[model samples]
Target: MSIDTAPEPGRTHDVRSADTDPDAGAVAFRPAFRAALDATAAAGVRVHEPGTEAYRRLSGTFNITKAVRPLAVVEPTTPDEVATVLRLAAVHGVQVAVAGTGHGATEQMDDAVLVHTCAFDELVVHPHERWARIGAGVRWDAVLEACAPHGLAGLCGSSTDVGVVGFLTGGGVGPVVRSAGLSSDSVRAFDVVTGDGVVRRASATENPELFWGLRGGKGSLGIVTAVEIDLLPIAQVLGGAIWFDGADLPAVLRTWSQWSSLLPDEGTTSVAIMRLPDMSGVPPVLAGRTTLCVRFAWTGDPEVGEEMIRAIRCVAAPLVDLVGPLPYRQLGAVHADPSDPMPVHEASTLLAAFDLDAADELVALAGDASGTPLVMVEVRQLGGALRTGPDCAFAHRDAAYQLFSIGIMVPEVAQGVVAATSRVHDGLRPWSRAGGLPNFCDQAGAERVRRAYPRGVEDRLARAARRYDPAGVLLAGRGLRTAADAVG
Candidate 1:
């Protein structure tokens, strides 16, 4: 098929073995493989083998704990380059892992070829068309910066540093999620390379099934080269957060839960019980103490937004109140997510109910006097446009809320952090549902993912995996498949 001028990978080759997996032993690159990679036809692709300084630098992942040394790291700039890597992987029966900017990496790609997409740095904004085309390498910050002048922005998650493709493909849940729905719903089209070296365009009118599967299926189908997504037209949002003392946790959490349950779709809200470190950038008042923070983002009139937010503010005396008008480009201020990478262990579950009783339990599980090692435990109200949004692979729209917990993975508290995460989820098990959001369950294995998708979504993903990635070239594709029915 005729397509856009993308790329061809593996113009040069440096071969060595990482042997990160002890059981797998050493891996070798054939002379034929080296020659293919060095061919003049493979003009623009770059390959870095293990044991080199460049490979070590490029292979480092954002999550420090889940690190792996793959056999080779392939950096591709275009669709043809991505296709070439996948084609060669399939032919040589080598496993491949698609590491797009590496934020959401879950698996250790042992003896596999790592396809890193940092070079797919293409971003083109079509202001009149109300959409932007971004490469897999692009981050939400770049998109927000490019679109801010035009009064347009994509529905990005709490952290703008996250890669666009990984977030959208996993069905993004943003600060404005309740108002705007999942970020994947806004995707217009995708330029992806399937496992068999086929470059395809997936949209509503072309390869519709693939389009549906790609929206919330992560990389179960293929590696995305570029994507087009609808951008919202507006300048500012009533976005910011309020913090309350931890001593008032039970009352504050319960009050916010009741008030937020009645919140309108125009407003998106989440509350977090945080224990901030007494370090730089930490507010003096909240430092070394537990605090409850309520983040609010209102897309409608600022006056009405203030009216809705006033209820939570009045529940308790705020240690700090930062709720007010904010530019769409500054939406990340609402969540105040840490900009730098850290070792973090996280867990999430959909809640069937989050009433006054559940709120009390949550406070006990992760509140001030609980002696919990968790850094933050949050609950996000979900409803309105989220339940009514265009459907694809995401399930559990009827869920009333979502429970998430994060713990920093420093050595002294790493074990405690993991334990605390399990405790929080186990304590809240009564109100919890079975499946987890794709974006939340980063380390979930195939069987766990199988259960994570209810309503036959798992079966559909497995079938799509077989169809697009028959040779099991992509690790995520192999994830959705069961052991009984093996792919090539």
Candidate 2:
């Protein structure tokens, strides 16, 4: 059973000698690690060394801006194997980071042991129970396709490709958020392995504290193996975007903001100013041009939705109108996010109010006339069901709008993106709230962690982290370590 002697049935390779370097502080605990690795390998785990091709492929993320160089990347096929990885990391004094689709890449891993959950692709839908059990690696698109035939829908974010577990753990906000609330609010249970190497089922009736912390705490608490979430009885929705020329930015933005404030709970909307590149997949009219896109999603009657959206339609002459009734699976068209992988830097804030002055400020900074380097600046309306969700770790319930900006991470424009994002934040400071959505805070610092949660929730999360992960082996949100230390 020695780690170096033989490879188990599903185990890929033996532990290389280079991985046992004595000078390496945490990963170099040789004697105890051999036993831990042997046990994990015997249980069908594959441990890939730093320079190996498997390690390189597993260490990469969807956010190309972050270059993760972990000490080792472990691929665990079953929940037992996941527990073994955590136990091995704890015993060897090495940190562990979970990568599920790698969309939300933060600077939370440094010389840590990364667990790639891509192989845990399990998806089962219970039409009678109106719930679905999805693996940590399953994407929203897969869930959507599985539930489509049953006239059900998962509360997936704008991009259907985003990982379900990561999105739900971070309090996912999607196109139907105003109607269905956060994606986390629908979770019935989660099968997770804490830093202590214990597999526990968390739910409202089970480990309530762990459930609350995991709902909005992201990966700071544990690595989720599978999640059971409630699905909605929604088959179709009247949703899409109406594009207008940049010349009408001011009028369209102000009109949409004012109109959105009067919208009902069934109608959700957002406005974005995009500077799309001239790529092949991009429409010729929108490519390389500053455009104003007004996105809307209505769960009500299609006729009523059309009547309600007519006010914005007549605000200014639109360049294109693609809004109409469509199946719920086509929700991605509402935002039209880039599907290709590219390096990007993003910054976001929740707004207390968005008035004419806020619109003017946005136009002066990121509008067509501003000559900004940022690609897209979006303002999404918030409230309704989103404000009435059950008390969880998610904060900013009373915020009126969410403002976020994204820019390419090219070497020539990296500094420019940072400066422009800071300027945008400063310009909208008057309307900005204290906290932001957990999913949108892309940086890895204590201040960003504090902003993701409210005043009291952070303390509770810190205590939970100490109780569940005393050794701090889970490095997904190491910034929260500062909060835990302050409370102690």
Instruction: Name the best candidate (by TM-score).
Output: 2
Considering only N, C-alpha and C atoms within 3 Å, which residue pairs clash in candidate 1?
A: 7-81, 9-45, 10-45
Model 2, residue pairs in steric clash? none
Which stretches in model 2 have alpha-carbon errors above 4 Å?
Answer: 1-43
lDDT of 2 by residue, 442-480 (tens): 877677687898768998998898888888889865777
Best by lDDT: 2
Question: By TM-score, how accurate is candidate 1?
Answer: 0.91
Q: After superposition, how far is residue 156 of candidate 1 from its true place, in Å?
A: 0.5
Over 302-366, each residue of candidate 1 has an lDDT whose tens digit, in order, gives 99999999888888899999999999999999999987667889888889888888988898888
Among all windows of 10 consecutive residues in model 1, the one with the lowest summed lDDT is: 1-10
Candidate 1: Cα lDDT at 74: 77
- Backbone clashes counted, model 1: 3
Measured against the true structure, the TM-scores of the candidates, in listed sequence, are 0.91, 0.92
Candidate 1 regions exceeding 4 Å error are 1-25, 29-44, 483-488
lDDT of each: 0.82, 0.85
Q: In model 1, state the lDDT of residue 100.
A: 69
